[model samples]
Target: MDKRLLDILCCPVTKSPVRLLAENELLALNRAIAADQVLNGAGARVTGAFSGGLITRDARTIYRVEDDIPVMLADEAVATSQLTDFPRS
Candidate 1:
């Protein structure tokens, strides 16, 4: 992800700034995904592994990045609260 683009991108719902998910955060998310414990805002099971993600500044939601494109749709957002042992810092 480009720093410039990231700097300009914000969560569509909260209007809060977003940043790239850290390695630990990504790991935790993927782990949950692999275990079939992840779901999107629309209440659909999130399948497969994500290459990367953009997390809201408040750390409440995560938007997946597929093929280097940010899927910034609200329904596609994943609530960070669902992941067990998710990173805090």
Candidate 2:
């Protein structure tokens, strides 16, 4: 995604700032978001912010990538296998 485009994109539901991910850390599962580990519920993750492609720390949503176009529509988004609580080990 382009830096100019990322600046304009926002969460379709929250209309809040959206950032990109590097290292494929922000996984897109079935067009939704997922992550192996996220630290918190409220904080945001940008990776490189402008350089990386769009992703979020919530791990429940993804800015859909379509034909080199980002469909940042909230309605088009879905959730991955939810892991609300992590085991204390």
Candidate 3:
């Protein structure tokens, strides 16, 4: 991801600052089983967000990652809380 781009990205819902997780960090986060893991829409997996993944502490909304670029459009994000509950197969 580009710093210039990241400097301009914001959370979809809160419109707040976002942090980009490293690939390994994302992988580890993806592996986490939140207390409500089974209730999230995307399930408990970080595959959707990785080195190129952007997250806001307010919520786990994830913008799309394409070509190593994170799509920070509000409409293109998935909440982290919502994503941290899917069963990985």
Cα lDDT listed for each candidate: 0.94, 0.46, 0.55
Give the alpha carbon lDDT tens digit for every residue of 1-89 in model 1: 88999999999999999999999999999999999999999999999888899999899999999888999999999999999789986
Question: Which sections of candidate 3 miss by over 4 Å?
Answer: 29-51, 57-59, 83-89
- Residue pairs with colliding backbones in model 3 are 30-46, 37-85, 43-85, 43-86, 44-85, 44-86, 60-79, 60-80, 61-79, 61-80
Q: Residue 14 of candidate 3: its Cα lDDT?
A: 79
**Model 1 local distance difference test score:** 0.94
Better of 1 and 3 by TM-score: 1
| Best candidate, TM-score | 1
Worst 10 residues of 2 by lDDT: 44-53
TM-score of 3: 0.53
TM, every model: 0.96, 0.49, 0.53
Angstrom error at residue 41, model 3 = 7.8
Better of 1 and 2 by lDDT: 1
Worst 10 residues of 3 by lDDT: 33-42
Query: Candidate 2: misplaced stretches above 4 Å?
Result: 26-53, 57-60, 80-89
- Which scores higher on lDDT, 1 or 3? 1
Pick out the ten consecutive residues of candidate 1 with the lowest summed lDDT. 80-89
